[model samples]
Target chain A: MKTFFTTGKGICIVGIGIGITAALLQKLGNPPNMGVCVACFVRDITGALGFHRAGVVQYIRPEIIGFVLGAFASALISKEYRPRTGSAPIVRFLLGFFAMIGALVFLGCPWRALLRLAGGDGNALLGLAGLVLGIGIGLYFIKSGFNLGRSQKTYFSVGLVMPVIAVGLLLLLITRPELKTGALFLSTKGPGALHAPLLISLAAGLLIGFFAQKTRFCTMGAVRDAMLIRDFHLMKGVIGLLAGAFLTNLIVQQFNPGFTGQPAAHSVHFWNFAGMLLAGLAFALAGGCPGRQLFMSGEGDGDAAVFVCGMVAGAAFAHNFAIAASPKGIGPLTPLFVGIGLVTCVVIGFTMRKKI
Target chain B: MMPDRIDARGLSCPQPVVMTRNKMDTSKSCSFEVLVDSGAARDNICRMATGMGWDVQVTEDADECILVLSKK
Candidate 1:
């Protein structure tokens, strides 16, 4: 069958669908400016699993489960599933770790940056600029032939691991498995407490997963392709996403245009940029956005699964160390950690370049 | 004779480029015109057209551009 979703118009529709759904999810109480954030959702999942003791940001987000499962289902139906691994797993993990840290500092990922902007958070501009700058730097490394090495095909079970984990998480979410005190913490308030209904959230995630899998959607990829090859295909989808979300926010009366008082947002402009700069650099090095990583994990990429695990661990570290920023403002150690992250990424970029 | 024209204004990035590419691919015409809203899209389409062995002329407007491509 001819796949319409892979075409330019189809991708635009997919972008619109994602944007509208995110806006609707926000209206349905999934937190303002945070209708769907892969990094934040993963952090919440990490907390729910008791990986971190952050009391205010613990929940088993079904959207994440749906992302993996939905992508798995799409891959299965399309016969596109190819389990693979062994591509500098440790480095990928470190990249994911720093990516999560950067995201936490900014309180958003690339996807959330656009969502925040569409919802009228002017502060997102700085973060967006940082993302572009970071990606531009990553492009230089790419031009210099920086590679993480090649991945080899692995057993089919390797591909099923992430999906199985997702299923296990969904089961835990549904059963509310009683654990001893301090075993599994549930947030009673804050961003972790904010959620759309489980089924609705799962459905939205599944739809996005299916479409994103078909379209190979990635915000980082969009920017990379534009800068490296002057290709605008992916950028069009991004523009579509922004336009769709903006229009939906306007219709829903959720558009609050300002830099201050945006939910789950901090107005410290410099850290916002620096945070995303770190995240964008990490994502470029890792070769996909957080959402793309999850999608890849679903399709049986064990390396991507490793990266996902690194993100979970990074989330724990962020909350435990008080490095994550809050709505009030930047954390005390944000600058220090962001500086470290930038140095680390630059070192990797330089050391990993293949001598041609 | 008037050349075929595609007014892809207000369309996003690749859409404008894709539309221009599609028209060029399907038509046997030697010359055509495409109107786009963004500088990026205008430049991208021109690059693609040039790579495809087409002569290109771009006329800029306030926030839009018209690219005329002739087969080389």
Candidate 2:
């Protein structure tokens, strides 16, 4: 049968699938307006691994493991599992690190931004605008002939590395292995504490992974395509996602329709936008959003795995240094970090441009 | 004049926009009517029409929208 996943309608279906799944996950006990934040989940994983001592945001999220495993399974079935690496690995890693820092500063990634808006948090508008602006800047770099060196196909075992790591994580989650004293760091409160049942979350992640791999659904790509090519093909999925989540939120009575007191959200607007601006630029430069990076990792992209590791480290840095924002407001050093991220990204963009 | 019509309801964005564009590209008629179920599709189609120098008239219903595009 012809693949419908790449078609507009099929992508819309994928969007609706993700939207409904996220809403349902929230109803089933994931955080409000945050059913599937890749950045936050990765941060939790970092903490759970004892990489960070952030007491509240510590858990071995099964959904993330499911994402990798699910994509791996889909790739294997489809014969798309070619192992590849060596495309500006260190640069991608730094981009991922900065991306996570920016995302945490904004308290969400691109996916969570949409979900926040769909759930009626007005604060997301600024962040979305910032994201667009950041993508526009990255597009400028692209138009200027900036390119990450091409990745070469690597050995088959390279492809299995990410999947093996995911399986190992799954094993850890299932065994609840002792970390120092008690079982792996499980948060008693905060976003990490709020979670859907392990199986449900994992299944949801797997389903999304399967579809996302088929569709190549990336929020950063959607915006990039729209800005760079004036093409709405990918953005149709984004619109569908927003509409789906909005409808689902309304149905579930999770739609608050306000600016303040939204769950896990702060009223600070400037930092929100600025933070995501940094994040959007990083994502664009890195060639994928966080979720997309995870999916790519699953598909045997060793470079994306490196980016994932960078994000985990970035999360560690954020909490340990108090650079991540809280629901109360921006962190003390968030501005400085955002500035540093912007400068770092701009330097990379300028230095990496090919002489044409 | 009886305008050409495209029923893009139940279709996602870009589909509606694509169908409308295809019709505009192939037809001799300078006017068309498009029906879309979602606001996003309606807006996108309207933008595409306007970008192509067509005048657009939008009518919003409870959960759907209708657009009429004519040469300006």
Candidate 3:
């Protein structure tokens, strides 16, 4: 039952599409080396909602909204929108929660890691190592029978929740409410303040979301499949991403290499590695990368919706508690937060397995 | 001889793979037949079983995917 999009070549096109879109977005005005960062954008959106007072990083990114809505549209069009829930929702939430903390520590998610590498950031090498190692640990658990149980089929409305939220957010973005009390929050400065043209960003998001849904493009899944089963089906997409981004960056002349002054990135090498490691483990446990989770939410997965909510809340906790990293360095409470996340993930991995 | 049967249909993701892993870890038999409805699940089981030094053969009809795995 494989369609044209499911083939290796097809998924490669999807990956290349995402790479080119992300690079193009950066060239268009998004942050350098950060065209479409899910975790970072989610944090910005969280800040924009006034969930946190991180002034430098608060804006309602249209790309995220478009991503969710686009995936929703694709799912509906393809008749693949199946509502599912009840697969340890709280644990899933916590996984997403810690995953965010981990990602923020590194200042990006898996896709951003690849993008950073394409932008010639040497720091991304360490982050990639951390991601691989973390996912490797999670693979150990998987080999030893780690599982979070199965999700049951739920109502159709359950699946529509995230998309509905996306629509509301789009409206809020359009209206541009002036409220000191609540509702919408926009950043006046910093990375959050920088963005590409709204319509173009949305268009890119929709295109990426549409093809990603069809091809099942997942960064974590690509790494996991490569490590665990040695199947390169999804890995091909990952390579396409790197190649596409690298070429685009070369064309745009944004390929600056060095660790001294990379944009929107810090050189705290240990934390960078540890952060992505924690994120990798969390993604492995949670069953998908952050963007994949968003796409799943679009496709009516209530479980993924819960995970997404957990991530949004995690962004708040990271900033409000001052645990997330900045360009200068790691936060004051980063070690404490990341330590707790690592131990918690290990406990979940061990305790949740179906032994015997 | 007959193989151990693992019906992983209706399950998603790591569950199917995890189920197969646990079964492979605990069972005495060297062969197994796993039933899965989703392509992801079927591929997961096939890969895990094959990686554990077993040969895997996959058969799919309209309803489900059948993975026949054996150690030789």
Best-matching candidate per TM-score: 3
Work out the TM-score per prediction: 0.83, 0.82, 0.91
User: What local lDDT score does residue B45 receive in model 2, on the 0 to 100 scale?
Assistant: 72
Alpha-carbon lDDT of model 1: 0.83
The model with the greater DockQ, 2 or 3, is: 3
Most accurate candidate by lDDT: 3
Report DockQ per prediction, comma-separated.
0.03, 0.02, 0.35
Q: Please write out the lDDT profile of model 1 over residues A161-190, one tens digit for every residue.
A: 999999999888888877667655678998
Stretches off by above 4 angstroms in model 3 are B1-5, B18-39, B42-72
Question: Could you say which candidate leads in DockQ?
Answer: 3
CA lDDT, candidate 2, residue B48: 66
In model 1, the runs with Cα more than 4 Å from the true position are: B1-72
Candidate 1 residue-wise lDDT, B1-72, digit = tens: 334988766442334555676678788788888976544356567667876789999887544578889988
Docking class of 3: acceptable
